[model samples]
Target: MVRNTLQMIAAGCGVLFVAGGAIASPAEVTVANAERRLEAGADISMTRWHVDAELILVLEKEASRKVTAYLQSRGRLRVVDVSVSINMDDRVILADFGPGFLPGPDEAEVFLHELAVTLRHYAEQAGLPIVGVDFRYQGKPLKSYYPAELAVPPRARIDARNQTALVSASHGLVRVHPALNWDYQRPDAFGFREDMITPPYGDALQRLLEERSGSGVNRARNRSQDPHPESNRPWDYMSSRYHLKTLLPDRTDIWNSLPNDTDADREVKEDIRARPLYANHLGVGTMISLHTNGHELGAIRGVEVYYHGDKPDDRPLAESVLCGMRELIRAQPGYENFPARQDASPGGHGENRIGTMPSVLVEIAYHSNAEDSVALQDPVFREASMKGVEKGVRLFREGKTCEPFVLQQIPDISLAAGTSQEITLPFAGHPQFPVTMEFTTANCSSPGACRPSKTTFDDPNTPITVLMRCRGSLTGDARWSVVLRDVDGVATAPVEFQHTCSKPGGSPAA
Candidate 1:
């Protein structure tokens, strides 16, 4: 019998040769110590100023080197592209495989199994977090591997897991896709189209990412084409409202004539799906689909973030980003009434669902509303919102919890003046026990008009609901604010409320 030599063997970042045909035990690879600057600002504190983006870039390179070297030594496949980054829970690798690959899907599975072992082994040696690796061949994802500890939702397939890598990388290179290039949002109340208003927010985020990276914070990469060069000039009006009439002559308005999903809508959906595909192709870890909401009811306005309900990490990702937006938007002088409206029931978003990574589509504000339209145009507001998004990702990666208290939607009230109406202000959070609620009114015609039925919530497990009674003595919109003070005497920023009242002594209306 003739004995064949081993084809490949591993030994401490070096290949070893053996005369036996049996596969060698996986090598004990040792990586060089990362740059020392990585150690200086590696603060994973509960509340941190910022993480060094340059250091993160260094780590990314190290991760890529390890994975690439191991695969290259195998001599069976080529790494077309590789993206390695830190996620909220684990390190993630997205690799595009070129030819000299396996023969079939079953073979791909076997390759993935071996790749998983190699990735975990090298990741451990480098002191990197546990890794999840997704491989793609010719634009199709092959079987991938995720660490067993990640909170995989029920029945999550290989593709879902692959997409989760993108969503879960809270600290990795984030891919931002500006609004659709072809579709135009109906003109805002001021006639400025959504295409014009929202892209700047995306641009601001891109700039913020570059600025942070430039300042040694975090590197942000955006590859989408700019759809609106005139984004900064939002005051220039182009109304799509009337143009739809050219498509539907018989219908009086686009809102009534348009189907739930038109060809145009489907095209937009496909385009949305294409973004994450491109992002995945580039090996990005996460993506934010930025947009602004529009509604026939101008009363609907605030920040909304939609996530894939089925993905375990999606909700938390959305919550974290929303918390960041709330923190910064509330800090602005005139944005006290800005609400963190409850997200549309999760899942059901093509942008969030059709990817092999975590993606969240955020409606930053409503263009249909007069006030929010102006807010969207304000550079200060744009910068604040984008910064919040940047911080939110960092916080999520660090596993830091944002605002414990999230104020849900507080609807517009049409109440009779001089009548006291009890309104339910629903809230969700894990508050420190023994928190007390305080109410205050601003821009109100009647002083001391808003009062809370219960001032204290002693249980941490109970949901927060404030039974507020407001007496409207005059016509117009008035503001009510709620402040929750914890046992430690720490108070949150006021939860601003708005209610409209009819003339005094008029019949009560909802």
Candidate 2:
């Protein structure tokens, strides 16, 4: 049974008083100067900006209540996807006790109440609203959310269309206006076991395996080198979480064009919206990337909100995450040893554009640190990690700006013609910060679908011209244009070149 009694989660303005009303049509709530609202005000501002990417925070936990607590705090929550990795060697010998290590009903309620209060505070400061809250703990997908009831048609299958159910007894049967069009109703949980690893992408991905195996990222990878499964890769060593083969198909599969012919970052930002973000009545959204950094590029400990040095959408999110990570990390009993920086400054001295999305790669502390190594072993760290994550999401919805991605150099310009000029532009700082430049032009006649049939940019910055030997009668003022773009972002700039076409040198076809 769920508890209905309300408790004070914060002092005065920060208290967690229940907005006593029907949650069935809960409206976006804020606490800066307004009272809690439960009205179903149409959130017209809610729109799909970028593809939703999972804010994965990895840790080993056995129903860590604290970890879950950090998640519930975010007031603008919808679907929470919580996953727990347990110590394989653990001898708990108490499987029958169920989620004993988890927070009890009272603790869960209070924890969630506190999370909501804290998140609302950040959202108010960031000038954004909150919505849904979801929990995907221990690999099992649980939620304190309902789908957009009005959006889903009655009698329509939930798998093919939108179908939502309320979590709270008071909400009754109502569907949510899913920020992204995703089916809340899934297939029966038969093969869904927590311990087993499922295919990253679904069958659609598995079918294309033979073809994707030939991609550059794979062909270029040294076959002999493989990181140990039991061990983590070095900070400098970026094991692609989106490497075509390994990433789960789910929303990421179609969103990012995984194992397919498209830019990886572009694929992530534009395609993967089904990945859960802020979920509550307000329908706020967020994106986060989790990876460990090494080599002490800067201060080693605490999670950081990493934004694209070239973009602005991720700046506010990054700042919020950095602040939350440092505070939460320093406060955790296990990780209290590491120094905390509340200012939460970002250190993305690496690339120009970070994959066309408002995202942050939280460096969850240094694996090299002896003290962090011990902290990492504790489940509380994951709790800290989740809190930092919640903060980042809240900040993004509030529209806070951290820093814009600086316009640096896109090196080794390799251009192609047909439909668009495909130039492989590599950034100045790190090789990992690679991007492609594609622009379309009337450079080719009798067009069906002309693209950079081929691209060559090993040095990256070296400007090279493309020659297309097409024998055809070319008659007209043939104009050519080059549009530089971020596949992952809508922000782009192009350069146009107008020239006369010639049919195999028929007086330059002038």
Candidate 3:
């Protein structure tokens, strides 16, 4: 089954062309990474930083205990600004920030997904690795924030688990090596020795896969062994506390199980499209929908990156993932970046059709990878993945690039031929933001069309209400749904709602 996967060059520097590796002029120490110099320096204040676009080009949003290490340790690599995104939870991604010249000025711009995609192609062609950050705010541009010296967020904390290392901060970004964990539910135990550094998840997976292939996916034939033996590592405070597990499989299974003709995917798709994060902001455009990619059976091994082919703008972002994966695979000393996509197939259509949508579905590694089992069983991956998820969110939300909270609580479902009841959904955003709510319905025919009978903004989280109005004449209740897009149009994950058409009041034809 030609699916959405791609392959390329042998182990080379992955997408993140950090110094010390092949990518040429390695990233030398810079003022940003100079701790003592920075500490003794003068007062540096942030000017402005905001994200107004859907995509942003950045090196990555890996974190450190102190801003000094983040920008300085790497040298010459002053964090012009890492492209990040924020959801209900703050998260960021290194790749979302991708390989780019990096941001400068009072700020870096996070364009809406549409605009970024349209223009990113030119940037990618020039051998650029910069990808886009997903911003959730309602079209907010990251304004310049400061004296690069002063404005940087406090140094982030760098920790390791099950041979996995993660640099993170409380509401900032965390760039972690993929060995951390492909599945959020799992986390490795016993951090990797300092000698073991995989570029990111892509690299880590390749390493583990290799050990297994050379030996076998099990305890009997393996050669490499866990260095840190902390079997009872405490629950990751952040992940466990927030329940930041990957999206439950039950949900995806249900989604895939539905017949294409079902109203479910249609309503949700409309909701997803209806709220293209930056659709409203003249400055903002489209977003590269980033999610914890996996398979219906949770059996796939590589990251399941999905991108919308319908949209030409997504070309660069799509290409970056495909190519970057290969680079990362080669960069990691150990590990193997396996491939299994429709595009990789001999008769495959090509790169154009890899994702379910323009979005990239990156299932970093199989939660089931044998090498990762010890780590995964250790449970470090959850915190590591959570850091990644948060980094992905933060890469788009940090600084002025922050998008107003996107309220995507829309739902699609069918109703009985003639019934009308009550329904509810979510309102994603900070409680303080002055959020406006609205809903509408379409595509009805036959005996009776179902509509929102009544809705109440009971809680602030999900706040769009619509009263369904029936007109057509069908048999059972007509199909209907609810949507709560942000002013910018970026929507939230969708849920389903169905109402009957047999109302107490005679088939009201409003």
Candidate 4:
């Protein structure tokens, strides 16, 4: 796989040389020189800063090719392309993977780790002074994973009965790393770490396999009920067994878990445990826990934003984020029907009860449904979803309310078969700026359809017209539920329209 990746990188180098213009001397390739060229109206695309253009081109080309090849080898063909850039000020290398690179939560985590390692090795070989690697998928920025720092030996142990990995590093209190508790459920497995199932780990078994000779599936079977007898340290076990390393001490935290004894007991314990961390980390702005929902009914879909009910300060932030996600989803194509909203009830989960700061746990669409899974995989959808949360954060920080955006229901319309009827629906919000709302029909007796005359509402107070149409040979009493959504894909209460279609000779009635 490495040889093939290298060969592909070599192939890409040929293309880069042919397309990349003439290379400049090292003296002329400084950051100052690049800035001067930019000031003189040189195309930004044609300039390279603080590095030789040809070398940068070669490195980027090779990195892109190798990353794509690496993902392909892991049975992922979603990554069509990759682009790498360097930030001179931060001394960080950023790699942006094109759409479809990450199909699921599991893939996203793995791709980042693998890509980081690959880029780090290449950067080291090229004598580049990069301090960290930042990643983006489909234009949406993701968390940065820095190289682990060398730490003096820390005391660590495994609680077999509790299925927790306890690490008592010198800098902080004892941190409990729960095993296989991704959904905050009681641990059932022995070998899996909480991080392994949560964000950043990707597929822990796959990572372990990458370091070992055998297949990941086969190696995972050797899950020991306890940590290696020889290595009492958690970090040691993680490195030697799963090839995993810790992020910076400041960035790391013990996974929060509530005892399953009782609701009151769990809440009291969670408060006591979380308050200290919150108080100490006063600089921490907010917290977001990522999760996906599973339901017996496969039809459940859309994004749910949850905030602590007890924390009134977090309500606005949660609402803002919810609005942002809804608007983003609505603005994006193919996600018009995707619903994003604040959960009606405040979240009572242990993670949400972190009292020190505003916290939100986003269930990024339902993973139970087939359609939602496909939507989740789409890079555009994923990017918009994340941007919504970010926009919410920005708004919250700026003390701006996200309540300006609103959608209103249009009156029901009855239309004849093979015919169309137009009706106007009035909505009010953000009067000065244009707002776009997508009109869609769902839960129809037949396949009811509706199209808005103008999706963009330039004048907020004015009514927008929608053309409701029905087509199909056989039709009786048809009930069509119209969902009106704003740019963020947040829908107003759906308005049900009743339409009656008679035979061609018979008159249509409402």
Question: CA lDDT, every prediction?
Answer: 0.48, 0.30, 0.28, 0.46
Task: Show where candidate 2 strays beyond 4 Å.
Answer: 1-284, 296-299, 334-337, 342-355, 398-510
Off by over 4 Å in 4: 1-282, 342-344, 404-510
Using all chains and alpha carbons, the TM-scores for the candidates as numbered come to 0.38, 0.26, 0.21, 0.33
Alpha-carbon shift of residue 179 in model 1 (angstroms): 23
Clashing pairs for model 1 are 53-217, 53-218, 87-169, 162-356, 163-356, 163-357, 166-285, 167-358
Q: Write the per-residue lDDT of candidate 4 for residues 157-182, one digit (tens) a residue.
A: 21222211111110111223332211
For model 2, residues 9-62, the per-residue Cα lDDT tens digits are 111121122223322111222232231121223322331111011101111121
User: In terms of TM-score, which candidate is strongest?
Assistant: 1
lDDT of candidate 1 over 389-505, digit per residue (tens): 765665565567765455565676666666556665566553335878776676675554544333887876665565433343545556767777654333565777677677655
Q: Candidate 3 at 426: error in angstroms?
A: 55
Local accuracy of candidate 3 as per-residue lDDT tens digits, 317-406: 333444333333322333332331211111011111222222233334443344443333333442333233233322222222212234
**Of models 1 and 3, which has the larger TM-score?**
1
